[model samples]
Target: MANFFDFGLTLDLLRLPFVQLALVVAVVLGLLAGVLGPLIVSRNMAFSVHGTSELAFTGGAAALLLGWDIGNGALAGAIIAALVLGLLSRRSSEYDSVIGVVLAFGLGVGVLMLYFYKGRASNKFGLLTGQIVGQDFASFALLMACAAGVFAVLAVIYRPLLFASVDPEVARARGVPVTALALVFAVLVGVATALGVRTVGALLVLALMVTPAAAACRVTASPLRATVLSVLFALVSAVGGIILSLAPGAPISAFVTAISFVIYVVCWAVGRARGLTRA
Candidate 1:
C-alpha cells in the first residue's frame, strides 16, 4: 500500500504528454461508454456490441492489409456492421442470426488479413490488444468531434430510444418511431465501439463500454441517476486505470478491467442488500 501511494505520488509529479493526453481522451470516451452501455443492455442490444467490435477487428486488419489508416478501418467496419444490424432489427426475429453471421465473418476476415500482414506484428498486436498509450493532436480533435456528434445525436433520440428500450410495444402504441430509434441507437453504439477501440482494444472493448454502466445500473433504479453514476464510475475507472497501468508492475488492461469488475461487484452487492432490506 505504501509503495502504491509512492507510485501514485510519482505519477502526480510527472505529467508526461502521452499520459496527459491518454487520461483526457480515456475519461471522455469512458464516460460516453458508461452512459450508453446500460441503455444498450436494457434494450437487449448487448449482442450488437459484440458484433460491432468483432467487425472493427476485421476493419483494422483490412486497413493494415491495404496500407490504410487503422482508425479509419475500425470506423468503417463498425459503421458497416451497424448498418447490417439496423437492417436485421427491422425483422426483429432475424436480428440474432444476423449478428452471429456478422461476428463470424468479421473474425474470419480479420484472421486472414492478420496472416497476410505477418511482418507488422507489433501493429497487429496493438490493434488486437490496445497499445495506444496516447492520442496525437489530430486524433484528440477527432475524438472530441466524434464525442460531440454522439452526444448531439443521443440528445435528439433519447426519449424515443428510452421508451422503445423500456417497452417497445407501449412505445409503438404511443406513436414513438421504434424503427428509427433502433437505427439511431445502433449508429450511436457503433460510434462508441469505434471510439473505444482506441483505448481498450477490440478484444476487451466491452470493459470500457459495458462494465461501468452495468455497475451503475445495479446501484440505481432511476435512469437519470444511473446515467450520472455510470459516467462517474467510468471516469474513475479510466483515470485510475491509466495511472495504475503506468505503475512499475501493472498493465493498463489489467488495471482498467479489474477496476471495472470491482465496481460492478460492489454495486451488485449493494443492490442485493437493498433488495433484502426492502423484503
Candidate 2:
C-alpha cells in the first residue's frame, strides 16, 4: 500500500512495451467515446450503450471460444447489435422494449460461450471487467484504424446528425434524412463502445462513453464546447487512471470509473450552483 503513491513506480511501468501501447489505446478510446457520448445522451440512447456493450461481450466470448481475436469479435458484435437496435427502434415508442430484450439475450449468450471456453479464468474476467496491461501491437494498430474511421464518419455527419438528435421531428421536417443519420450515428457509437469494451470492459464502458459527456453537458449547452470538454474529461480519466493504477496493482476500470463519477458529481454541483446564483 505504501507504493500506492509512488510516482517512480508509475514511470517505470510506462517503460513496458504493453503499457506504452495501452496508453495509446486509452487516449484514442477516450477521444472516440468523448465525441459520441453527448450525442447519445441528447438522443436519449444512453440505455442503448449498455445494451450494445452486452452484445460486444458476447462477441468477445465467442471469439475466445473460437481462438479468434477478441477485438474483432467485440467490434462485430457491437456493430450487429447497433444495426439491429437502430432498425428495431425506428419508432421511438419501442426503443426501450427492444433494447431491453437485446441486452438480456446478449448477456445469456456471453455466459453460455464463456462457460464452454475452458480457458484461464482471468481472460474471461477481463472481458466482463477490464485489464489495462497485456495490450499488443496488433490490437493497438487495429484499434487506431477503427478509431480513425469512426471519427471521420462523425465529422461528416455531425451537423445534420446533431439536429436529428436534438429534435428528430424537426430534423425530419427539414429533410435531413433523420432515420438514415440515426442509424449511422448508432453504428459509430457501437464502434466507440467496442473500443471502450476493450479498454474498460463491457460493464464499465458507459462510464468512459457517457459520464464525461453527461458532466460536460451539465455545464455547457453548446455542442462544440461540450464535445471538447467531454473529450478532455475522458482523456484525463483514461490516462490518469492508468497512471494511478500502475503502482497500486489496482484495476484500471475502478480508477477510471471513479474518476468519471467524481467529475460528474462535481460538475453537477457546479451546475446547480450556477443556476441558484443566476436565479
Candidate 3:
C-alpha cells in the first residue's frame, strides 16, 4: 500500500504541473457545480444530470475511438442529451421514465464503445471514474471558456429562472418564457456535468453537482444563502478531496464523494435539530 502519511511526497506531488492543473480544474468545476446545483435541485432535475453524465461518458468514449478531443466530444454528447431530455420529459409523469430509457441506452452504447477502443485501458476507466491526468492546458482553457459562457447566460436569466423553478405556473402566467428557460437550463447543466466528469467521473458527478446544493437547501430556504453555502461546500469537497488523495495515490472521486456525503449528513442533522427545536 502507498504511504498515506507521506507529507513530503504529498507536498512534492502538489508542486507538479499536472497536479496543479488538476487543482485548477477542481476549482473551476466546484464553482460551476456550486452555482448550478441549487437551480438543479429547485427544478427537480437531479435525474436529468445523471442521465446527461452517462451520455457524456458515451461521447468521451466515442472521441477516444475516433482520435478526437474527449472533452469536446463529452460536451457535445451532454448537450444533445439535455436537449432530448428537455423536449421529451415535459410532463411530470413522463420525466423519470424518459431519463431511465435514455440513461440505459447511453450506458449500453458507452460500454460498447469502450469495448471497441484498442487504446490504453486507463483512458476507458477515466471516462467512468475520472483521471486528472486526462486534463491539459488546452482542455482546461476550453473548460474555462465554457464556464464563462454559462455564467454569462445565467446572469441574464437568473431571476426569471429562479422564479420559473420555484413556481412554473405562476412564472408562465407572468409571461416568463418557462419552456425556453427550462431547455436552456438543461444545456447549462449538461455543460457543467461534462466538465465535472473529468474530476469526479460520470458515475459520481453528483457529488460535486448536486450534493452541496442539497446540503445547503437543508439548512436554509433562502436561495441566495443556499447558493453561497453550496459553493463553499463544493469548493471544500473538491479541493480537499484532491489534496487528500495525493498522498494515498487513491481515486479522487472516492474522497470527493465522501466529503460531500459527510457535509450532507451534517446539514441534515442540523436541519433536523432545528426542526425539533421549533416544534
Candidate 4:
C-alpha cells in the first residue's frame, strides 16, 4: 500500500514543472468557480452548469478523436449547449426538462466519440475524470486567456447579473434586460464549467462550482461574504486536494470532492447551531 502521508514524495512532486502548472490551473479554476458559483446557486442554474460540463466533456472527447485542441473544443461545446438551453427553455417550467434532454444527448455523443478514439486511454479518461500532466504550456496559456476573458466579462455585468439572479421579475421591471443577462450569464458559466472540466473532471465539477457556494450561502446571507467564503472554500478544496493526492497518486477529483463535501458539512453544522440558538 502507498503511504498517503509521504511528505518527501509530495515535496518532490510539487517541485516538478507539470505539478506546479497543475497547481496554477487549480488556483485559476477555484477563482473562476468562486466568482460564478454564487450566481449559479442564486439563479437555480446548478442543473444548467452540470449540463454545460457534460457538453464540455463531449467537446473534449471530440477533440481527442479529431486531434484538435481539447480546451477549444470543450469551450465551443459548452457555449453551444448553453445557448441551446437558453433558447429552448425561456419559460421557467421548461428549464429542467431542457437540461435533461440536452445532457442526455451530449453524454451519448461524448460516449460515441470516446469509443471511436483509439488514442491514449488517459486522454479519453481525462475528459470524464481529470489528469493534470497532459496540460502543456500552450494549453496552460489558453486556459489563462480564457479565464481572463471570463473575468473581464463578469466585471462588466456583475451588478446587473446579480440583480437579475436575485429577483428576475423586479429586475425586468427596472429595465435590466433580464433575458439578455441570462443568456450572457449562461455563456459565462459555460466558459467556467469548461475550464473546470479540465481540472476537476466533467463528472465532479460541481464540487467547485456549486458545493462551495452552497456551503457559503448556508453560513452567510450577504452576497459579498458568501462570494469570499466560497472562494476560500474552493481554493482549499482544489489546492488541498492536489497536495493530498500527490503522495497517494490518486485521482484529483476524488480528493477535491471529498474536501468540498467536508467543508459543506462543517458549514451546515455551524448554520444549524446558529439557527437553533436564534430560535
> What residue pairs clash in candidate 4, if any at all?
none
lDDT (CA) per prediction: 0.81, 0.90, 0.93, 0.91
Q: Which ten residues in a row have the lowest lDDT in candidate 4?
A: 126-135
Q: Model 4: per-residue lDDT, tens digit, 2-73?
A: 579999899989999999999999999899998898999999998999999999999988888999999888
What's the distance in Å from true for residue 172, model 4?
0.6
Candidate 1: tens digits of C-alpha lDDT, residues 5-124? 577665663487877888888888877887798798788777789889989888988988898777778888998899888986678788899999889999988988999995557677
lDDT of 1 at 232: 86
| TM-scores of all predicted structures | 0.92, 0.97, 0.98, 0.98
Give the least accurate 10-residue stretch of model 3, judged by summed lDDT: 1-10
Hey, what RMSD does candidate 4 come out at?
A: 0.9
Cα lDDT, model 1, residue 167: 93
- Model 3 residue 120 lDDT score: 94
* The 10-residue segment with the lowest total lDDT in model 2: 129-138
lDDT of prediction 4: 0.91
What is every candidate's alpha-carbon RMSD to the true fold?
A: 2.4, 1.1, 0.9, 0.9
